[model samples]
Target chain A: MPKIVDHEERRKIIAKATWNVIAREGLGGASVRSIAKEANLSLGAVRHYFQTQEELLEFAMQLVQEQVTERIMEHIQSHLPPKDQVLNILMELIPPEEKKIEMQVWLEYISYKIRKKELQKESVHEVIVEILHRLQKAGLLKEDILLEEEIVLLHALIDGIALHILMGLVPIERGRIRYLLEKELNRIFVE
Target chain B: MPKIVDHEERRKIIAKATWNVIAREGLGGASVRSIAKEANLSLGAVRHYFQTQEELLEFAMQLVQEQVTERIMEHIQSHLPPKDQVLNILMELIPPEEKKIEMQVWLEYISYKIRKKELQKESVHEVIVEILHRLQKAGLLKEDILLEEEIVLLHALIDGIALHILMGLVPIERGRIRYLLEKELNRIFVE
Candidate 1:
């Protein structure tokens, strides 16, 4: 009997390898062949999953996004108070110890997009909007805030903090990212 | 007599060439040979000033800093009011058609630093603090703001805005960067 391969498992493995390649050598080094080598898969196997480097990169980005979403979903079920949940979700967007790879890979994707003169697909924007909607639904969003402006500001704040952390321009004190996250959250949300 | 060379002028020319190379091929492509070819200078001539690629990259960054300082000084001499002066100086830091090369090269340097796991020396920090001090001296700084946090926040905001511009994630509207800058300025300053 032929061995059965779990396609999802194989994909997750490939994406992990893609992130490793990006973190190790930047986007330039994450070619399909290199990612195949990193994943310990044959070139044919990698190509069977992703037809091109761009496809592989896009999947890698989605993997990052999905990891954040999964973590947030796991945390949201813990029955934390609404504000704390928002804090937790917003904080999750930044680099904690375990999330460092995700943040770095995400930045590499952004840098790649910059070099290509393309805008990212606004999925990150969607994530921000989704977070705000949840906050509003939970009655945690402040009434005085201009919703659109607040969203843009918080998006910029998240981008700034992540960039700072990845660049090592800011110290990675455990609570420092949370501190900034809370400060921005308070500006737009009622405690 | 040896060929007369103004060391400072040659250095500036090489730095300009360096920026062009970085803009064209990223930091990875700014090797000494390529930079020499870009500048149309002999490899020995280029090596006479910058002994290694690392030294050449560092000098390119310093050139970026000097260019910004020169522009700000010229703007300050225009005798605008302190608020307008601050606005002009801050705007000079972002891409304004003429400064796009500087912004791109500076970002490449930053991305290079991130990959190298180094912290930028505090020259940019000094510039931010200097601006805040001028604001206070001009009676424009808000009383309740935490100066240090505000400084860090403004630095991150400037960085975030520039990254957005370079990424084409944000439209390059002339007023857009200024809008973000003014929002942060209003947060920290009385005006």
Candidate 2:
């Protein structure tokens, strides 16, 4: 009998390999051949999971967003206080020790998405909007600021922090970035 | 006698080609061979001007920075008023015109420098420090904020705005981004 592969397990393995390729060589290097080599799978086997490079990249990007969301939700659940929940959500976006590579990969993917219009699908916008709504509903966001400007500022703040950390300009302490975020948040939102 | 080539003109041609490649195909595609093709020069001719790809890229990056600095300074000099100078500096960073391509290329180069440690030379740091110092000396920056934090926030603000413009989430209007920048500046600097 032929050997059976657990579909979900295989998907996870491929996604992890995709992240590795992105972290090691950037989004440009996350080609099918490179990812297959990184995953220790044949080209055919990699294609068996992802039909094309775009499909693979889209899946990887989705996985990254989902992973971040999952961690944020989990952290918020553990902390009952809204302030702590907000703090945890910001923390989840920073370079978690074990997930640093994933964060790096996600940054590259987002940069790519910015230049490439086809990549800016509704799903990505939805994810951003959903996060903005959550923060607002939690009353963690400033009510005085327009929701659009606040959303823009929040995204810019996070991206700015991520860029600095990745560039080694700022120390990679979650507390430092979170503190900065809190300061900015307080400037806009009433306590 | 062999024909003489205008060295300065040749250099400008090559640099323009480099920018074109970066705008079209990104930094990864701005290889020596590809740049030569874009310049319509033989590889040997291109090499005659730039000894190596690294040298070529460094010159191109510096040129982009200089162009931006020149524009900002011109606007400052022409405006005479400090508030207008500050507004012009912020407006110069936004996209949706000829400068849009330059901004895109600069973003790519900045992100590229993050992954490549060898590219982080003293000159880059010096340029950043000088810009920060000039802005602070102009009394445009908040006095209470540490200089280091001020520098970081400026970078974040620019990067954030650039990313949003590139992502199409924010409309590329001089008034829109400028208004946002002015608001943030007021919050940070003005009482």
- Chain A TM-scores in order: 0.86, 0.81
Please give the C-alpha DockQ score of model 2.
0.43
Which candidate comes out best when scored by DockQ?
2
Question: Which consecutive 10 residues in model 1 chain A have the weakest lDDT in total?
Answer: A168-177
Error of 2 at B82 (Å): 4.6
Give per-residue CA lDDT, model 2, range B87-144, as digits (tens): 6766666655656666666666765665564445433334445666876787776777
lDDT of 2 by residue, A1-191 (tens): 98998888887888889988876666666788998888898898789877765677776777787777787668757946665666667666666557766666666665666566444543334544676687778777766777777667667766666666666666335766677777876676657
The TM-score between candidate 1 and the true structure equals 0.77
lDDT of 1 by residue, B82-181 (tens): 7677778777766666677787777666666666667566455567779997777777888887676676677666666666666655544657557757
Cα misplacement distance, residue B1 of candidate 1 (Å): 8.0
- List fnat per candidate, in order: 0.30, 0.34
Q: For candidate 1, give the lDDT of residue B164.
A: 62
Clashing pairs in 2: A142-A189
